[model samples]
Target: MIQAMYKRTKIGCEVLIQQAIDECPISTIKLYISRYYKKNNQRWALWARQHSPLLLQVTSTNSLESYHSELKRTTSSHYGLIGACHKVVALDQKQRTDSEYVAFEFRTKKISVMGLDDEILNEFHKFPYPIQRMLADEICAVENRIEKGKAIPGLTSLHCNCLFFIRYLLPCHHIFHEQIYGPTKLLTTNSWRNFQLMFEESGFEVYFHNELIEVDILEQTKAEKAAEN
Candidate 1:
């Protein structure tokens, strides 16, 4: 879907993508706006449609031949059909979630994630290109119901979503805090106990004393047994 959207936008257009943070020549980035007339109005939104440029590129003779061939090849391949259905569902869920979250981030810039690590940090950097391109393309694609006549929504949302998903959501859901946060997010038993003690001393109610006592006892028992040996 990303590839198709990209191709559709790039087929007969020139899109300007932002330089990566490291590659950025200047500290401040200037915005680019589209100036096409009808592109500025969403009044004709019903006429706007996304289509496969690949389909348009195929020669008429070969295209019809391929279409007929594909139609002729259709069979009761139940397993393949089921797999295709699953793929569609997965893709739909992904696209829906992506668009929703992107839209959300567009509205709000701040997002939080719990876990972080080197692996996730690396992957976060990698997925931005196509993401930025798609966003840039979308911004240029939609000129109706939008002001400033540019892809600022796409640009800002894409960057924020990339940062939020990579730094927060992925870490919270997938990576271990130990890997990402290293020593910061981790709490040793002693540290936790100390924190609880401080909380209690400060008149904050905490209910994990029993669990902490068990941990303390287990630690003491292990130390005593090792010393005796």
Candidate 2:
């Protein structure tokens, strides 16, 4: 119950904790809850609301650190200034090419809908790309009400109760299930289109002015000295 409470919104969390305080059987549980969670529980759970949207599938920075480590392995302290510059330029070019390739794939490839029913697939297209991706990745069944045993009917009510959906304004996996089984439909929004455009335009060089004039000057000076010798 405590862990579940942590997953809820700030006000929802407070309400649940208050309920727990009122009904908990053990005095020590009540005392601990009052001391730790009553005052500023929001601070602990704020990241779920703030970072979950941007995080997507990543839950930690370990992958980023691992990439940095791999990059370090590819570079060497023994390389001269020109060699280092060339290496950096080569790596940058490779990354740019890879990014362009990914953008191309995203533009060209159709999302697979082999198993989804015709109705579900039609409804899926109504959602933005991010929401669609989220639904595809985290597929699940619609949750039943504990008291009623009836499935939730639509995305709006599910979105209201779901912390992830509310925080990000993206459909949660549960809502995806609701869409599949019920009359729930994800509405089209400018946010997804804007996001797609932003991603497609990322790393595109708007202006390319050469900034290696100092290196050019040094090379010119060396050439002159060599000619004189």
Candidate No. with top TM-score: 2
On residues 13-100, what C-alpha lDDT tens digit does candidate 2 reach at each position? 7777788889999999999988887777755554344444443233468856865675677789998889878877877787779868
TM-score for all models, in order of appearance: 0.17, 0.49
lDDT of candidate 1 over 111-135, digit per residue (tens) = 2223433333333333233233332
Clashes of each: 4, 0
Which one is best on lDDT? 2
Candidate 2's C-alpha runs over 4 A off are 1-52, 55-59, 62-67, 122-131, 138-150, 153-158, 183-229
The lDDT per prediction is 0.34, 0.56
Per-residue lDDT value at 129 in model 1: 32
Against the true structure, candidate 1 reaches a TM-score of 0.17
Alpha carbon lDDT at 106, candidate 2: 49
